[model samples]
Target: MGPLTPDNYELVLGLICFFLIFGVLGKVLLPRIERLLAEREDVIVGGAARAEAAQAEAQRVYEEYRAELAAARQEAAQIRQTATEQGAAFLAEVRAEGQQQRDELVAAVKVQLAADRVIAEAELREDVVQLAVELASRIVGEPLGDLPRTRAVADEFFERADQAAGEVQGSGAHA
Candidate 1:
């Protein structure tokens, strides 16, 4: 060539610059990029492992809560059964005691009725004897003035009284 052109010189310089820049970038920058990518991958893997461990711990706690709930239900059932038994026992005892009191009250009433009947009989006998004496004195018109006759009437009245008392006592015993 007689003289180098400006365009040809510029083209040659641009090619040399491009080769130098690519060579330096490949040697120095590419390894650093690779190391950064590896670090990012390690961080992602470690985070996934931690998340899995947390999920397992949560499941274990849930199982423990379920077991405790079952135990509580069983305990409540036992307590209810015991209370029911005790209530039944207490009711039976109260009923027995009430029956005993009623029986005692009935027996006392029967005894009091018997005692009142005996007292009434005694008083009736006394009144009958007095009326008989008064009627006999009026009929005789001597007021049972003679001692022997009076004594005989009195003895007859006493015998009749004894017979009536025996009959009443026999009837009461039968009843």
Candidate 2:
């Protein structure tokens, strides 16, 4: 036999050793390794499931938040619209009250002005009558002063003058 070839007894012993080692690895270490691999697979799959559940929960919460936000925005818009309408109504009411007050003030002022004009006309007529009496006394060269008669004459003269002025103003207006 060649030097590379084993003897029959050595070959039988090597075969026995190989069989023993293979059986030990198959019965003991192989099962342990398979159990470890199963555990690792469970960990990876469970972790992925948990991550997916967490992502689903987060999406639900985000959707809920968006819905609430949209509701809040709509509520705020309604509030603004209500406030604007109320403000417009209040402005209109205030403006109407102000206009009423202005109209009343104008009417009162016109009434006061008319009363003042009548008072002024009466005072001017009295003053004119006194001046006429004084002028007539000076021109007649005596106190031809019958006070009642002189007042009556001045009143008649003013009535005629007022009539002529009214006629002239009426004709001018017509022209």
TM-score for each of the candidates: 0.54, 0.69
Candidate 1 lDDT tens digits, 1-175: 4445557777789888988888877877877888888888877887788888888989999999999999989999999999999999999999999999999999999999999988987687667656776787788776654456765766687789789999999999999
Backbone clashes for every candidate come to 0, 0
TM-score of 2: 0.69
Q: What is the lDDT of residue 104 in candidate 2?
A: 100
Per-residue lDDT tens digits for candidate 2, residues 1-175, read: 8889989999999999999999999999999999999999988998899899999999999999999999999999999999999999999999999999999999999999999999999999999877777787899877755666787787788889999999999999999
User: In model 2, which runs have C-alpha deviations exceeding 4 angstroms?
Assistant: 1-39, 144-146, 157-175
Output the lDDT of residue 7, model 2.
97
Off by over 4 Å in 1: 1-44, 128-175
Best by lDDT: 2
